[model samples]
Target chain A: MNNKKKIMEDLIHGIFLILGLITVGCVFLITVYLIISGVPAIRKIGIINFLFGTKWASTAQDPKYGILPFILTSIYGTAGAIILGVPVGFFTAVYLSKVAPSKMRQIVSFIVNMLAGIPSVVYGLVGMMVLVPGIRKLFNIPDGASLFAAIIVLSIMILPSIISVSMTALDAVPRDYEDASLALGANEIETYFRVSVPAARSGIAAAVVLGVGRAIGEAMAVMMVSGNAAKMPSLFQSVRFLTTAVASEMSYSAGLQRQALFSIALVLFLFIMLINATLNFFMKKGDVH
Target chain B: MKRSLYKGAMKTLMYISVGITCILAFSLIGYVLYRGIPGLSISFLTQKPSYLKGTIGILPDILNTLYVIIASLLIVLPLGVGAAVYLTEYASNKKIVGIIEYAAETLSGIPSIIYGLVGMLFFCQFLGFRTSLIAGALTLVIMNLPTIMRTTEESLKTVPNSYREGAFGLGAGKWRVIRTVVLPGCVDGVVTGCILTVGRIIGESAALLFTAGFAHSVHGFIDGLSSSGSTLTVALYVYAKEQGEFQVAFSIATILLILAFIINLAAVGVSNYYRKKRTV
Candidate 1:
């Protein structure tokens, strides 16, 4: 009876151990799968031609599989979104964390959560209907579904992440520091912007990095509003992102075309991994301060 | 005079940012509802789209979403909760714990589109699950595992070490103590995790698109898992982007919006209830 009980405990412990390892297993699985499927196309096209050549006619008679356009578009779009979104989100975070009354803060936090919860497809649908047309009318563009429309939608989509994360960081600023700032004759706004902001800078940096990850990884909404054209990115021109480059062609792509899509996904995966590393670095720094 | 001007400018900017945030939120919610609510009807909610009859319905997409959520939740709960339990209660080595936690963080950071490609490659092709709802659910299980694990681990941390001590003093084993004491205390975490996972599954489009191809046929749970279908998000994408069916897309978006609101409320309610219980 005693031996049987010991054996049962051992079995359960082993089961739990396996469960704990499953997450690691999944990470390993995804990395391996992406590399395996993503390598063949690169080998065929040559890495330089694949990554730098500007033209992308995957289905043409003489396929030119340069993805510089997608890469540039992704970089430009994410930068535009950060430029447009960070200031608003940062100011909102300051207001909520340092200035707003508790009740008002609670309400705003709920709104932020709601904004985060709204489906990406819904964002896309609304962008397609409103922002696309609005851009066309505002700028006298032939088509509203340009990189500009995508940037606007992405900026809105990333706001919740930027606000909530920065708010948490701001709230974590030591109360005694703020008290010290006040004692030194600094106004509330001055203390918050100068003292509290610097103290929470690492956390805010992490928030911006997080937003970058979200913006770059986004596919469907960008696909809908960015017009899915393989053009070098211009603010007012239709362009395809790295994500949409993979998504737009995956369905009907065959042979090298399909392989190229996988390669695009692989490139995207590398970008995400790089962002994740930076985010981790900032997050760890935030923890220290 | 310069200092006062600087302060006033900073204050004005802060308030304007808050105003912009609120305006964006209210306008989004209001517009989706305003455009979508009028398009919803009884038959529209109950029947499938029929080309011959020239009528459209999202009953299939709704049912598909339900099936995928239920399936994914059933699979993810055990794995996530068990992982959390192990990390909290059973693990003795700090290195293993760190590695597991790091892996979970990495999983959470991965894009859903990558999950789609992998799900398509592994489950749909390699495992021969094909482009089916089950494949999609499995992919979601991976996507949401980190969420459930983190929430459960957090709540497990709150399940006082004294409870375990007391159970052990009564001559109970480790597994026994965990089954009775640890698991029961993390109910709020599991509930919150489930609600969040449900919201994610509902909102998920990029991951489900390829793993579960865009089919609108309705089926029973078991059959549905084996067959290809589109969730509501995917359906909305197809209708609006591919078919020029704006009305149907808006309707689906509104439904998704309402579901998202309810899930947010449920998450808050559960956490609040647990907090009160702990306090009392």
Candidate 2:
């Protein structure tokens, strides 16, 4: 009976160990697969030309595999989204965290969660039908699907992440910090902005990093509205983002073109890894504070 | 007077900013519902989409979504729950725990598109699954593992140490203690994780597009796993982008919107109920 019980315990322990290691296994699998599949195209095209080339014509008689345009568009799109989303999100978070009555806070926070819950495709559809035409009419551009429309959609899509995260950070600020500032003759608004905001800076930074990650990695919604043209990004001009560049061509692409798409995905993965590192850094700092 | 002016001006700015944010959220939701509801019908939910019939039914897409959710959850729940158990109950080495936690975090942070690419290469190509629903479901299993593990780990932490001590004092083995005392206490977390994972799978589009090729045919669960099909979100993309079928797309969007709404409500209800029970 003792031996049998010991064997059962051993078996259960082994099962739990295997299950625990599955997450590590998955991370290893994804990294290995991406590197193995994403490298050959980079080797053939040469990293500099592939990463820095100014033009992309995968199907042209003499194809050029430049992806500078895609890279820049992704960066610019993410930056634009941050620029547009952060202030609005920051203020709303503050209002929800500190100023709003409990009832109003409950209603507003619910709306924010709903915003987060809406599928990205719905945003794309709305952008496609409403914002695209509106942008064209507003700017007198012949085509409505441009980088600007994509920026708008991305900014809206990222708001929920930013607001929720910043709100948490803001909420976690020790109440005594604000009380101290108020006791020192700082008004309520000044106390929040001066004391609470600075105390929660790391959390707010994490929120921005999260927004940047979301915007940079987004594919379908941007694809629907960005016209998928591999041109240099201009605010009012059609452009293809790094994500859309991969998605638009993967269906029909063959040989080097397909491999090149993998390389683009690798580039995107690297960008996300960078953003994830920054997010982790901020989160650690927030914990320390 | 000057101090009051400063306070008044800052307060006004905060209110304006918050008001604008609320307006944007409400307007988007209202607009999507308004546009989508007009095109929705019972037939749209039940029939198979066909070009020959020139009819737009999303039965296949709806079923595909359900199958993917069920398939992915069936696999993920065990692995995720087991992993959480190990982390909370079995692990002694801090280094191993840190590495495992970091891996989970990295996995969550990686975008779904990368999952689509890697899933295409590893599962579809190497594993010979082809572009089938199983491949997509497997990909989603990876995507959702972190969510389940995190939530489970959280709830496991909440299980009082005294409960574990009581079980051990009674001469119960560690495994028995966990099976009886720890697992039951963490049921709320597992349920929450399931709800969150379901919401994510329903909203997912980019990852599923490649792993599950967009074939719009209705099949039984088993057949659907082997074959290719589109979920509602992917179907929305194809119809809107490829087929120029905006009406069908809007109707699908409306259905998805309703699904999201219900999922959010369920999540709130579950957490509230559990919290109340715990307080009592």
Candidate 3:
């Protein structure tokens, strides 16, 4: 009986060992598959030129995978989102923790959480219906769907992530800090900026990082509003980013084109990993400070 | 005073920023309610999705969505909770614990598209499960694991040490102590985590697109694993993109928004209640 029990214990342990191994295996498999697919494509289109070129003619008999323009568009779109989202998110965190009534805070915070849970496709639908029409009518842009549209959509999409994380951070600030600031004759705004926010700096920074993750990962909404044009993205000119580039072509793409699409997925995966790790490092270091 | 003027400008900007965040979120909700609220009928909730345009019944998609969520939770919750327990209750070494925590957090932050790519290659190719509900649910399980682990860990941390001590004093084994004492005490936390995970799953799109197969069909409970089904989110995506059918997408959006909003509101409330109870 004891021997049988011991064997059962070993079997259960082995199950866990395999499960853990599979998680690690999946990550490695993705990296390897992506590299094999991407490297060959990069060689076909000279790595230097492909990485730096502006034109993206994906349909030529001998096509070019010059992703520099798309890469640049992604970088700046994320930058636009972060710049638009973080300050507002930070202040909302301030207002919720500092100024808002309890009822108002509860309602607003719930709204933010719901916003975070909203599927990207829903954002895409609404953006097309409301924001696109509004942009076309008010701005007199020939195409309502443009890089600017992508930026605005991404900014809104990332808000729930930014606000919730920052709110948690701000809530971490002890009331003692606010009391101390008040004792120093500083007004509420002064105290919030100088004392409370700084005290919650690490949390706020984490919020920004989370925001970056959300904005970077967003696909469906941006694809809808980004015009699907593969030219280099100018502020108002429409262009395709990496995600749309993949989604737009996936259903029909086959052979080398499909491989190249996976290559885009590879590059996208690496880009997000870099952003997350950089933020993680910042958060860790800030905590240490 | 110049300082007073500076302060006034800052206040105005701060308020505006807060207002902007509110409006960004509210506009989506308001738009959905304004359009969808009037069209929502009991019949709309009771029938299946159709390729036939103009009729707005989402019964099949709603049932499919619920099937996927419940199925995924059944797979993930036990596994996630067990892993959390092992890390928290059994593991003694700080190094191992830290490694587990770090891995879970990093995995949580990975983009769902990456998961889509992996699901396509690993599940569809290696496992021989074509895009179906099972595949999607398994992928979602991976997606929600870190959430459950992190949240359950939070709740476990809040559980007083005395409960475990008391159980052990009665000669209860480790598993028994956890089953009887720790698990019961942490029920609210687990519920909160479950709610949040449900919210995440309900809203997910890209990952499902790869694994759940885009072909639309209604599947019975056990057969649900084999058939292709569209969740409400994907239904909205298809309508918005390929068909350029905006109104249907908005109506779908309205349904998703209300579902997500209700769940989220509940999660926040239960989490707050538990948190307050623990403090006392």
The DockQ of each candidate is 0.85, 0.80, 0.51
lDDT, candidate 2, B21-73, per-residue tens = 78998788888788888888898888997779889999999999999999999
Candidate 2 lDDT for residue A57: 95
The better candidate by TM-score, 1 or 3, is 1
TM-score of chain A of 1: 0.98
In terms of lDDT, which candidate is stronger, 1 or 2?
1
Chain B TM-score, candidate 1? 0.98
Candidate number achieving the greatest DockQ relative to the actual structure:
1
Greater-DockQ candidate between 1 and 3: 1
lDDT of 2 by residue, A15-133 (tens): 99899999999999988887888899999999999999998999999999999999999999999999998988888999999999999998888888788888888889989999999
Error of 1 at B90 (Å): 1.6
lDDT of 3 by residue, B132-179 (tens): 888888888888887787777777777789989998899776656777
TM-score of 2: 0.98
Residue B150 local lDDT, model 3: 70
lDDT of 1 by residue, B1-280 (tens): 8989989999999999999999999999999999899999999999999999999999999999999999999999999999999999989999999999989989998989999999999999999999999999999999999999999999999988889999999999988999999999999899999999998999999999999999999899999999999999999999999999999899889999999999999888888899999999
Candidate 2 lDDT: 0.92
